[model samples]
Target chain A: MAESTKKKKKGGRKKSDAEMEVKAEEASEQADVSEETTDQEAIAAESAGDETTDEGDNQVAAPKRPDPDWQKAEKPDLSLDERLQGLEEDQLRQMMKDMLLARRFEEKAAEAYALGKIGGFCHLYIGQEAVVTGAVHAQTPDDYVMTAYREHAHALQVGMEPGVVMAELFGKETGCSRGKGGSMHMFDKERNYLGGHGIVGGQVPLALGVAWAIKYRKEERVMQVYMGEAAVNQGAFHESLNMAALWGLPVVFIVENNRFGMGTAWERASSLYDISQKSKAYAMPGRVADGMDVLDMYRVTKEAVDRAREDSGPTLIEARTYRFVGHSMSDPVHGVYRTKEDVEEHKEQKDPIRLFADVLDEAGIVSQEELEEMDDEAKRISAESVEFADEAPDPEPSALYEDVYANEDVNGRLYFDGRERP
Target chain B: MAEITYREALNQALAEEMERDPDVFLMGEEVGVYNGAYKVSKGLLDRFGEMRVVDTPITELGFTGLGVGSAMVGLRPVIEFMTYNFSILAFDQVVNSAAKLLSMSGGQFPIPITFRGPTGAALQLSAQHSQALEAMYAHFPGIKVVVPGTPADAKGLLKTSIRDDDPVAFFEGEMLYNIKGEVPEDEDFTIPLGVAEVKNEGSDVSIITHGKMVHVALQAAGKLAEDEVSAEVLDLRCLRPLDTDAILATVAKTNRVVILEEGWPYGGISTTLTTLIQEEAFDHLDAPILRVTQADVPMPYAKGLEKLAKPSVERVVEQVNKVLYR
Candidate 1:
């Protein structure tokens, strides 16, 4: 917390609009807990069992492998020079602008949800924008992208129109999926954006098919798929990872460890909390990236994308990040599994947008006026999207039967209830 | 036209389609080097190379989703489950991902894929290995369900399923693979989905059936002919876009109706046909519609119990006689 305060004033910088927003959250990082503490507690819990009270005898009988040093995987102090490698000023500005747009868009969506404009489970991407924005920046326009339900940021990063995405959330005919797929499902085939899949870890296997097509068609492209850290426990995750590695498919599997999957924390849900280490069983390179640092996410993902494009194999990346908001709009941001102080600590210390903005300032890259102008542009775009969504028309009643089957013209009757065909 | 076994006909259809479209590829357990567990894909590995003919591990859910994903990007993937019973492991991908992706994505992605394999009871495959799941797939809307009973129907319908722009669940009878019939030699021959054919012309009762039961109904028709009762055997090639017009036409042709099925009677194609006939063709009926289905229970392993559990020609004959009021 002291380090963040010192770094905030390193350049003696003025408080921009975005920085003022983060100052409101007032979050801090907790003291690091060593892995040895967990092991000792587990050993103590085992000794409490009726069958084994003698700790010395149990330790001698069953020896365990030394725990991996996962702390080394984090790049908290990624140098400014490394961050600027191959990045132009314009590109850097665009990335920051895109991240701001995603934040403003989610805020507007939250407002719309409260006004009853958008319905259903409305999950917001208020935080964790760096994870998708950085990863997507490393991918080509032809490269495919897929992710779980928390994906408004992903769609925006892949160049989907903010207005169309807002229209989808409004369930308007002008939306991305013509109003069918709402918050959890966003698709733009024109952009090679597969979708915002709702099922946990369900998009992993589908990414394999995209990679397979890349190889079959002799294209130099990679399929990047993202999922929550909790999804690593699913059978689909393991099955897909095994197949992707076994076949040398061009796929990059990224797990965004936002600490919690809904109400359950990652530690309580996974026996071995190091998700990247699980890739060892599949004979693939597993790397860790600082999800809070946009450049770190970009650097790690670019390496994996290059490997996939070269047909070397697939890579597993565990991006360490956190969510400042709840799992969805209906849930409380804190108090069920996490405390208010903990959420505040993350907001103050590891806010991705603030951290990236600070980096731009430290490098003397973007001026205060430019940053303010970018923030204004983001707000304007989000406001315009809301207006467009509000004015957009709802799908016609006859539109319901459309897309049920592509060959509906040739196939038998889709409806058995004898509803008149449109 | 050339006579070929149902297994060979299926192989020919796959080869012809793969030859026609580079996007069409075959993937399954033991499909490449193993030549398929049932030998349905024999010699495809050497012919198409390893890329087009993929032999994946025994991961049904994984490979099925892979097929759906590939289809999302305009690749026509034909995923084979060694047997339809094994498809239970992949119901989530088949039912949720493949069947619902088009409608859920608002037609953004039309999954041009096919899942084909042997279905129904094969000797003493018993409870776990033997199952006719066409009704389970037909229950869904986005996917088309095809159950071809004859070798000629198998070739024509399989070619059509492979070329279909939407997801199709193609069920081939395990017991009918070796049954030889005159299959067309033309590569362009494809029977459109949701169409039915009258296997036998009769003036008395209409025996409505599909898959393996079509043969049973045909046999019962032959037996009924000796008793001066000419029964028509109608084979429903596809179940989802069901041949309702053909079904009602047969109902009008013969007032008496007998529905036959190899799977469980409750909440299946048999139940669906009974409801359809009564609802739409109720006025055409002279006698109460009788259905001959597998005894309602889990298929037992014992020979006597298995025979009793399955729909047989004798059972069909009895139902036809009752429908004929003989």
Candidate 2:
């Protein structure tokens, strides 16, 4: 059985002409060489017994696989134009702007992190913009959104001001978390964005609680939680899924399958490559979306959100996506586990922003000049946010004692360390 | 006031709070249909229905996080851990999510959630089930830790915990559940957290404690009275918002102190009180503070070893006598 033929059968769609052009551009010899390199590296690294105790060891090699195989895994049909139907021109333009804004914001964040303006583990959402933006497009402002540490894009998508998000990175009082919660914890209660929880799969159960509240209150709201593919291995993920399905709660579980959990590939870390299939154990409908295509992501997420709001129960969506950057600011873009060629191919062929822009252009929904203007506008907003964060005041030293308890007056002495309060 | 068991007091508090506020709901293992593992939620399912009194699968971490999440969204959720030992399974959600959510979110969300469960040794339930976890919980800054030793305190403190806009870790005494005491009849009867009560007043020495240890301290105080050495018994109902003024007052009055706790001596609440007394009221103390704590080892299953492991009235009395320089 040929691998390409198998993928075609599972995809259930013939390749579009544009896809064929990109495929023809990739030399077959280059793919073969990268496959050989991956196998040799995996075997050599395994035999050497190279184990690292370093916490920043994002260079660990994943289990060997032919480089092209995981890339050709099944995805939604590529007729992104179909997804543009029933949407007004303004909505499509907003979606484009939102994705661009996320990309531009992260680019600025990466720059700030390099200049020592941001501290702590800053995980940028550079390449995975479409996944969150499209999912947000499917949600109402009243609906809740929660995700793991890689959530700058999720914050922007859920309508958090870029200035506040940047200020959070800068640890300013004006940050969404009031300078207390740094890079990994972004929260906006008014926008219904729960937080940027740092722990892996930690936000899923919280999402379940929000969903349970919605069900208990007899409200027609949905709670959507996003996590990386690595979080699928967490016990909380399975436990949350079981309860969400058992109670028929209105929640959507989205696993942004960005191909890598830091350095380890999804295929290397997971026993089963197909993460959506795990949802079967929880008795929920498992759907997969082409995460790079914003329209397809919106379509699948909308269907799940509708089902949940109508009280049909939760849906588990495996949004097949890729991150164009390192796991965090400290890591390299591509090395150790993945080849530079592989990264380049994905960047050229499936860069979510570029792909969406092309779809918009081909469908006549957006002009090239309009897309350029949107990108420039996004850059301006992102650049100004940096200035805002740079000038934002630091939290007052008195703030150290504040917010430890909701009603500290009634709770009595909260700080026991004997630090004098000014 | 009405005579009731500690169990009944907790039940009354849950029922009254749920009845008072529609947002207040109870969730835990065997809480609804099974009427709770310790039957603390008995008749709540029938009274409030399954929606308010929820029965959940044994996913402690999941359900606990769910409760925190619900509390984040303005619902007052009372999550019952079958035992404080089992709460270790949900420790992350308690410490990481529930306790830290307020401070970490920069006070955006106030988690009005209560994690109540039977704590401390009950017969030969062994190490896993018989551990006291108040010290570990009280260590966190954002959470309020309460231990109600008597029926009245159980009803009053629990009502206050549910109403407070902070996450509260309410530790119920497993051995004191069936103990009877007088409880106020008022539905709104509530005790303020972070307040200490003098269970018995004296001036020779002070036996300071909380939770089940309060009874042991009182017993020791009675023994000291017989020996013509008066001892003050102070019960610190809440740990995080510690009654520092009350503790200091007791220290000043007694001039000697003996701290007691059911947890291990190393890093126990006793260690904290001793440090606090020496730091805040050093000149007032006549002798170094002593602590009566569980043996520095895991709880044993055998009767003799288990008895030896726990802090007893004899141990508390011995510590009091030592502090009094007898």
Candidate 3:
């Protein structure tokens, strides 16, 4: 492995497409073995004139041999499931339900967007639910927060009602932003969440500036700034990191590396695939956590945030995660760019929420029946949110002009009778 | 009750505002320990602590953005660039984020920020540093651009700017900051944005100007006064949301108007004001409106050439006389 790491670093002088294609072909070869076994069963069934119902389980038990070179040393199994090592069975089950609800809510948002009930650029937070819910629970309520456009889970994690979030998505007057920012711009100022910025790399420097104020005003607060891998490639990320490290600003830069950015994979997007190593350029501590694992994200972000509160400067965490859905609803979930097998493998083998439920069941905290009941409870809660948003009122026409300038319409009332607002 | 220079008025206004609001602070290169390049922030660091009075690294973009971000979270930050030429280096932050935040946030955020520094041609500090950008800055909304002429206006308007909910790009005349006038020593005093003052009233010709050029126009009016040509001088305090009523009324009464701007001749404030007066008060004008402005060429660092590049008292006098006689 040491020799291979050396060879990989030495061979890092711009890999050719042929090499990457060769790697992909080798990985698919193992999957071809499974396909071949299924094909053999199909042929046997055709010859026998009766189907082999137990063929899948038979193939799985024949030889448990996974491809050696094709296998990625299974990422220490994303400690989120491990950290629930001994959580009370009932509590663990509830958390898994929260994660399931978050994932379901995101799926519904994608459906809503397709139905034209949601508008603007909607970046789904389906696979990264555990990261938001876990980190949010560890932070103090008064702690300042800000993130880029993929922010539905952040709002939900901070305990915003699903109805208000959906109402904001629908641009209703009852929205957190008063229907001003349809989707990419919703902010709950009362929650200390600055905004859901649309510009790709704009939040880094702004969040750094907030940290400066925290240190300047001597406030016992820290900020969690979320950015995508695409933004980490931008100038603001480097620029803000330099100052944040230089000044010892109270901040935790959470880079949610969800494998693919828009359409490009992480290896295609970043020269340094391991982003934590890039943090050394600014002389700050950078850690990597499995974003799929909620407990792992919570544990690491909590340490970084606590250190920030103690005036220990900044920390960067590169949360390695994946998106279950496409970049936006417009993207094809089963397209040629990604194989269906690759997704099914993650969904079955390493889902953060599913694994947590298994831990709870194994601990006898909640049986399978009890877990199903929690899912039912969450489904009912989510079904009611759609109706609440649909019934939410639209902001008045005058609302368009009201916020342009502060109280700029002192004389505007003279143009009409004061009682005509309705 | 003491008469002070426009520069002293600005210093006093900062001292007062900082004393008044604990959240208010000033930051810029050379603003604190070095007094200021122009001494406009002199004695502030002494009056206020280092936190309230800060000296920043030579980074306009960094400090300007810091001010904007701080303002968003309920801090009042007064950022001074050495001059408007340096301030232009941070134009993207100034224009895109600070000014657009309020409107883009749908009024969720108020940028109670003030960016003040010297503007217009300073003899010998030319070309790189002596450009006027009021027209460039006034081009943006969600920001109020104030170019104060007199000491009274400098103090009052600056106080108003510090208190304004919107970001205010306040201009301190490089040449006229030292010029003296009676600034009312009142605590609760402020001149509203978008209001012009009749610095000197007359009937033959209405001469409009702002910033350092206001002094030049008043001087030109003194010369016109000797020639029995009564020139009314309008000091446009705020350029955006310009007090068109004062300009139109004065232009109609005088029937002749000459607007002087220290910027390059093309698309100067003179062009905007001349077009506005001509369109609004065209029938009342006996002679065509005229504009006296700087030479279109870049201001050379040579003292004599720098003076030649900017609109001067002689140039303002020349334009006013031409408009009045014609």
Candidate 4:
């Protein structure tokens, strides 16, 4: 009887620790709950211009966001006429459908991988769908796009065939990289999507280089590079930013601040999490957006991308957002540092795709039946991709000799003397 | 034929290469209106103007990365560090980004960049300011390491480096720039990378060295000649993808070898050459390869101590004598 009482006492102790985590998440999503992390909230608010903290030296005031005076912003009148006004309800409805389908697809990827179907590090951009969807839909295929490893949504929303990407993830020869590069290395140079880079801050320099190339070749191309907030701490980020600013390269640096770097929250890892404030260090324009809201992400990114093409130099955009899943598929929500309450709160209260769909429904632009139809289409497409990946042939043994080098110096011959294609 | 200093030959190479390719340009701290820190690029700015010949700020990491980024975009940027010692600050851009880009990108990207500057020790420059990093750089791939020992080779190699499809570390010896030599009169002349030339051919034993140390070996060979030892001297122009065939062939013929490198003895170029000859040319029955290198200590400012720390003709002679006698 006494031992049973002790077990009950132990259970009570576990419940309150869980409660403290719940309180932390609620306090984090809504507003301040912890006094120690209050400075982060105040700075974030200042960055968005939602609040001002006048009494503090620690408070980094919102940047002087010299947004392009769009009325005076130069564009060929013919080009402006051709620009997608994004005013159509159908167009918005279509984007909403894609976003929702992507949401379901990612959530399923998490579940499917949990059953051991996916083998690699599978990072889901479930909460931040709007970042890519909004930006990708706004740009034409001629523009260049590159992003970090949390890139499945970037690839899908960029209109890369889902089947190819899924097949690539499965390490099949028919996949994007012919089974060599898994998820973090999907690239389509033909489409001007320069990469999917694995290193955190390494891509920043390379992308700026691409922009420099575009300008040098007199090609009117814009290079958009995506990275996380924690990557800003690295030296290459700062070094590249300074050169880009000085040279006035046509590049856009986007920071997907999903509130955490792997397991540590931005508050714990960053003194100033709002990357826009740090953009001042380069003397470039910095903008903030509700990363969960597609419309806001669209407006800001479009403005930045236009400025870049106009040869007005680079812009740094910090998308304030959250991630619904763990850093990767292998991580479990309960077993990790984050509480289940936090993930549940994001899934229930602030689902970006759901939020956008709700807006369209209120406007009567898209109905429940139309949405369900798109969901079925996406699910079938996803299922077909998985099947295609399973069927995709592995690379031939003779392919090892190819692409290792350019033509050799002697007689312009191939470098490797290996089995030829049979 | 024309006689010119290695410095003048280098300037001439830059002038000719820039004239040939509009995409080729140069940028460094003191290379422009201020001339060059080594006076190697003395009159380039007036000829090329501010766009092609740029004077950069003191941010080595920033500008070197800029040069690297610029190179990836089809611009052939010849970056001049004040010296190899200063290049350490931008080593990441040099080694990680430029050297590894071609291989890691799976050969999709080519960075046509060149980092040229004075390397190794000269006189009493002292420790923090002096180092010879040939072996360290030779360890990496996708980078071509060129150390020219003569005026003709310097000009020809510099020309070839500017046109190569890879990043090149073209190190000029500080003390050898003003040394005059007979250069080819043919304006269209060029030398390919990875080729070693026999500076002085003899049969008793082969003395191998690169950069300024090549001069030491040649002088030692002359001294050994008086003692009836016909010491062969090989000037290793390109260090990486080392003319191993040439080294091995010379060792096989001479049947004895002595390597002279300017850097400290530990993991120096001498060690690499000795290891390779022993492994590949072991049956050639060499009388134990001898390495004459800088003493295993930090270089001191005292002229006497600095001279003692570096490879000298006297030491080279002793090593050659040891190999031949043994």
**Candidate 4 structure quality by residue, lDDT tens digits, A87-113:** 487668767766865776676666657
* Ranking of models by TM-score: 1, 2, 4, 3
Off by over 4 Å in 2: A1-81
Error of 4 at A370 (Å): 3.3
Q: What is the lDDT of residue A92 in candidate 2?
A: 90
TM-score of every candidate relative to the true structure: 0.92, 0.91, 0.80, 0.81
Off by over 4 Å in 4: A1-124, A155-181, A334-336, A363-365, A391-407, A410-422, B185-187, B264-266
* Clashes in predicted model 2: 0
What lDDT tens digits, residue by residue, belong to model 1 across residues A1-422? Answer: 23223433532332222343341221210112222345645676568763433223222112122223232244545467756656898888888998899999999999999899999998888778889989998889989999888988898899999999999999999999899989988899999999888778788888888888888898898999999998898888998999998999999999998878899877777765667757867877677787887887887787678778875479899998878899998989885798898789778877888888998998988878789999999999999999999999999998989898998766455567666766
Interface RMSD of each: 1.1, 1.1, 4.0, 4.4
Q: What is the C-alpha lDDT profile of model 1 across B244-303, one tens digit per residue? A: 999999999999998888887778888888888888888999999888887888889999
How many pairs collide in each candidate, listed in order? 4, 0, 2, 0
> CA lDDT of A301 in candidate 3?
76
For candidate 2, what is the lDDT?
0.86
Higher-lDDT candidate among 1 and 3?
1
List the pairs of residues colliding in candidate 4: none
Instruction: Write down the TM-score for model 4.
Output: 0.81
| Preferred candidate (TM-score higher): 3 or 4 | 4
lDDT of 3 by residue, B1-326 (tens): 67999998998899889889888999888998999988888888888978788887776766777788777788888999899899876776688777767665667887888999988877687688888989888767667789998899999999988987778899888888778999889887888787889989999988888888887888888987888889899988888657877888898788988888888767777877777766668899988888888899988987778778878788878877787673
